[model samples]
Target: MKEAENIFLNLINQHKGIIHKISKMYMKDAEEQRDLFQEIVLQLWKAYPTFKGNSKFTTWMYRVCLNTALIYFKKDNRKVDKAPLDENIDIMDVNENEGKEEKLAYLYTAVQELNAIEKALIFLFLENQSHRDIAENLGISEVNARVKLNRTKEKLQFIIKKNGYEF
Candidate 1:
């Protein structure tokens, strides 16, 4: 049991960036993001035993985290008020350019306007996942992933532009 726990903790620490990204993509508030993050970890732990290692850990992680976020959002019906970026969010990039940070902030804000599946599409796209991978993760067809991703990008751009921010 201890060995399993240790391995799980190590894997989580190694791939925590994935969790951070998923939580932030789903939630706008720092506190809410943290809560969602915890919930994802809990879900992951519970489902860990079912991992048969037939696929990459990350693939499994993404499915669990995304499902958790979608369900969490529905269960809570959360509506986040537009608040300034919290210093606590792990948004600090290696580039550290203020302009880039501001741009990213606007992007995140615009992303909040997206539906859950749309947000997942954008998130997977930004992560450089191919349509096939996105489809596999989302349990959809590859062609559907590509079509939805293209449409989601168009919608996200419209949302940002509508919010008075230029690309």
Candidate 2:
């Protein structure tokens, strides 16, 4: 138990940023973000032993984090309504010179509009996973991964345009 706890703690310390990033991307409110973070941690701990180290730890961690967030969103049926257009048009203002927060917000809005499979695809794409790796991780064909990624990018572009953003 002590050994397992140590391993889990180490894994958490190493991969915690993924949890934070996913939570921030998916959850709008502070309370929901905290809940999602905790849930990701719990799910990671639960799935630890099955981790065979066949992939990089961070790669495996991304899979687990994405899976947990996707499942949580599904199970809770928590739908995020797109904010009314005039209510806060400036919220989507993205500055290329700025840091990740602004860019991430735009990406998050685009991501939120995607369906679950597309969300997973975009998540892996943004993480810089190759089509082959994404296919292995997602259990799909490499051709399918490539095709879906292209379509997902187009969908994201459409979402950005619909939201009045030029990106």
Candidate 3:
């Protein structure tokens, strides 16, 4: 139990940002985001024993966090009810220096328009995982992953244009 706790702590410390990122992507409200983050951590702890360490820890963390967030979002079905633009929405002025927070906010808003699966694809893509890795992680064919990614990108582009925002 001690060993498992240690490993979980290390993993959480290293990949906590991924949890924050996914939660922000899926949940607009602060309370919801906090709830989702706690849920992800709990799920990760529950599944910790089964982790085989075959893949990078961050990759594994991403899979777990994404799955948890997606499942939670599906169960609640509250995305449609949430405000399209909330005070938490962070818009970046591209004219000035772009920081991580600004990029993350823009990315989150763009991803909010995507379907669940598309959002997962875009998340992995942004993580710089190879198509093969994404396919394996997502349990889809490499060809399908590539196809979906391209389509998602196009959709995002269309969305940005429709919103009158330049990427």
Candidate 4:
């Protein structure tokens, strides 16, 4: 039991960024993000014993993390208010320059406008996951994943432009 616990801790520690990224992608506010992160961790812990080693640990973690994010809204329907545009949260790696930081924040703001599935697809795409991997994670055909990814990117671009961002 102790050894299993240690392995799980190590795995989570190594891939904690997935939790942060998925939580940030799904939840807007800091508090909701924290709550969702904890929820994902708890779900992962509960599902850890059932892990059969058929996939990479990170793959399994993605499944668990994305599942939690997908269902999180079903449990809570309150319209959580988003933070203002000027105060950008450090959800992802930001540039040292103020201009780049604000641009990334604007990108995130555009992302927040996306639907739940669109957000997941974009997040996986940004992670550089192959189309097959994205499809597998998303339980869709690779062609469908490709189509959606392209459409999602166009939609995101439109959203960003509508927000008055040139790039």
TM-score of each: 0.86, 0.80, 0.83, 0.85
The segments of candidate 1 whose C-alpha lies over 4 angstroms from its true place after superposition are 78-98
lDDT of 3: 0.76
Point out the worst 10-residue segment of candidate 2 by lDDT: 83-92
Q: Which tens-of-lDDT digit does each residue in 79-136 have in candidate 2?
A: 7443322211222334457666767777786777776667777767766789998887
Model 1: lDDT of residue 107: 81
- Candidate order by TM-score, decreasing, is 1, 4, 3, 2
Best model number under TM-score: 1
Whole-structure CA lDDT of model 1: 0.82
Instruction: Give a tens-digit lDDT track for model 1, residues 1-63.
Output: 999999999999999998898888888899999999999999999999999999999889888
Best-fitting candidate, scored by lDDT: 1
Question: Stretches of candidate 2 above 4 Å error?
Answer: 78-96
lDDT of 3 at 41: 96
Listing every candidate in turn, what is its Cα RMSD in Å to the true structure after a full C-alpha superposition?
7.0, 5.9, 6.0, 6.4
Q: Cα deviation of 161 in candidate 1 (Å)?
A: 0.9
TM-score, predicted candidate 2 vs. hidden true structure: 0.80
Q: How close is candidate 4 to the true structure, as a TM-score?
A: 0.85
TM-score between model 3 and native: 0.83
Return whichever of 3 and 4 wins on lDDT.
4
- Write model 3 residue lDDT over 21-131, tens digit each, in one string: 778778777999899999999999987887898877887888888889879989997553222321222223333555756755666777787777777877787777899
Q: Model 4 clash pairs?
A: none
